[model samples]
Target: MEKFEQIFKYVNEYAEKLVEANGLDYLEALLQTLEDTLDGTFEWQVEGANKEDMRKAIQIAILKGMRKSAQPNHQMTPDTLGLLVAHFVEQCFEHRLQHGPIAVVDPALGTGNLLFTVMNALNGNVEATGVEVDDLLIRLAAATGDLIEQPVTLFRQDALEKLLVDPVDAVICDLPVGYYPNEEVALDFELCASEGMSYAHHLFIEQSMNYTKDGGFAFFLIPANLFESEQAKQLHKFIKGHAWIQAVIQLPENLFASKAHEKSILILQKHSEHLKAPREVLLAKVPNMSNREALAMFFEKVSMWREGNDQKR
Candidate 1:
């Protein structure tokens, strides 16, 4: 752990230097520093470091840069939450893992942190795709993928815009919440608001499900009041028509600054004749993340649920 801290410190310092020297944004500077470090342009020697450790090192540096920037849209998914999502992915998609490499996409791929975290946890047996509109973020995501030697294809465009990529086995995203600005674009979506701006998160869910192969799963970190909003009735109807709700795991409220900001992981499987809805939705409230015994019990319940769910397939 000390060695990991040292690596993070080195990266953070170098990134800060670049930010000052080149008058660049912290995230851009951080990207350049990571690229330079990998190319031997930077003199940091990381001996006996595994890929996951190296990735975490970079992630920590990026987190600091994000704090310095303080942009709400630039928020990276917290590592704890990312790891939990990865665990759910591994458990739910165990059958796909047994067969071969699985393809995954993140529509709101900010900094690629959540996507890469899941990819690394899967031991790199993944075909990853990320969509982002920000130039710096897409570049950072691409560079981070190169540094980690993970093959990730990225698209630089509005995530809600028409995607050219093919459908994948699974979809994962920390859904970008708020109103989507393009009212014209929103009109094309089934979940578009009848009289006002549509929720981007709702539209993203629709878009994600569209790109997913039949019977594929989508794991989304959605707002806690997802079903309590004014547009939720339409959203609920759309979902019922298209997919099966597998689970809704409420994250610990303490993770956020306030109750209103709390989020939950919603797991949905696209509708297919071969796949039946789970006998019961796995609705759960996570305990404080520091409680190891509680967390263990929680996952044990997940394991038992998975076993029973598999029998239905």
Candidate 2:
């Protein structure tokens, strides 16, 4: 097993045990446990840190037992949001350690994972704001920001109805695939997810694009259905003519805690000369590891994507 794998195993075990032992929910215990066990060590502070030390840090988080990070009645936190957050952070770091945009937004930020993850990635540069209707999710997310000691703002508002007046530099999100949905078609989420016959899971992809600052990047974890077909072609035309489609990463089913194994990562930048839409979709097997491992692998892949077979637009 790899070094980070050991750490992740410890964290997961600790998280699960703590949740069961203390009768806390998974997301509630995560931030506090993570904060205690793993100090916010930047890339530079991690100089020459051996694998064993990394493993120990994870253990410490586990041994810390419990803290005040849990929230009551949080909704839609069934591990999907955690995985999405991990994926977004991977892309943020893969972008050469440079915070692409100041204002980062996620319209359907379930449990604030997307915002929190980007906050983790940007470390401070990216000002994140997430809009969710659930008050419980909002409170928990706010608590998570406090635990991480980073300000990840969350708003209890309808994303579809209210748009940010301020300009957005980059927008990253993982939209719902429409399992349980509202009736309003004009809702920003439905408008974005409408890909004809079965809504695309990561429908926020377009909303993120529409609001993203010019030349900023748009990264999303979505199904392969968005890759090909005439619908995809038309969408591609809309994006290609306006923005630079950075990379299309095809992932396995394990990428998220979903039944559908069909998955992929779509990277888009608003009009950039540095990146070009990939003609051949890059394939990647989803790591069967925990959410953290999946995220680590995703970030590692972002670095790989930057170096691998790519075209200059």
Candidate 3:
């Protein structure tokens, strides 16, 4: 851990230097730093470091840069939450893993942190795709993938825009909440608000479902009050018509600054002839992550639910 801290500190300092010297934003500078590190220009003894260590070093550097930039939308998914999501993904797709590498996509791929975290947890058994509209973020994501030596294909466009990608086996996202601005584009979506700006998160769910292969899974980190929102009825109807709600795992509230900021993981599997909805949704409220015993029990419950559902199928 101490060694990783040293690596993070060096990377962060070098990125800061580039930000100052080139008058570039911290994210852009961080990308350049990662590129330099990868090409041996910024020389670090990372040859012997494992991929997880390298990923962590890059993540820490990105977090520091985000704090310096102070952009709310630039926030990366917290590592703890990302790891938990990865655990859920691994268990949900355990059957698929036995066959071969699975295709995965992150529509709101900010900095590629969540996607890469899962990729690392899965140990390279993923064909990864990332979609983002921000130029710097997409570039940073690409560089981060290259630095970590993960093969990630990235698309630079609005995630809601028509993607050339084929349906993938799994979808994962830290859903971008708030109203979607493009009303004209919103009109094409069934979840579009009847009289006002449509919730981007809702539309993203719909889009993700459309891009997922039948029987594939989507794991989303979403606002805790997602179903209590103004557009809940429409969103609920859409989800019911198209997918099976597998679980809704509320994250520990203390992880956020306030109750309103708390989020949950919503796991859904696209409808298919071979699959049916779980007998009961696995609704859970996670304990404070520091409580090892409580967390273990929580995951055990999840495992049992998964096993029971699998047997039914």
Per-prediction tally of clashes: 0, 1, 0
TM-score per candidate, in order? 0.96, 0.57, 0.96
Q: Write the residue-wise lDDT of candidate 3 on 1-313 in tens digits.
A: 4666768878888888998899988888888888898788897764467777877888888887788886777878988988999999999988889898999999999999999999999987899999999888888888888877899999999999899789999999999999999999999899999987899999999999999999999999999999998789999999999999999998987899998789999999999988767788899999999999999999999899888886235
Per-residue CA lDDT of model 2 for 159-183, tens digit only, reads: 6554753547666666555432443
In candidate 3, the residue pairs with backbone N, CA or C atoms under 3 Å apart (3 or more residues apart, or in different chains) clash, namely none
Number of backbone clashes in candidate 1: 0
Candidate 3 total steric clashes: 0
Give the Å shift of residue 27 in candidate 2. 8.2
Sort every candidate by TM-score, greatest first: 3, 1, 2
lDDT of 1 by residue, 1-313 (tens): 5666768878888888998899988888888897897789986766776767777887888777778886778788988889989999999888779888889999999889999999989987789999999887888888888877889999999989899879998999999999999999889899989897999999999999999999999999999999999989999999999999999999998899998889999999999888778887899988888999999999999988887886256
lDDT of 2 at 137: 56
In candidate 1, stretches whose alpha carbon ends up further than 4 angstroms from where it belongs are 311-313
- Compute the lDDT for candidate 1: 0.89
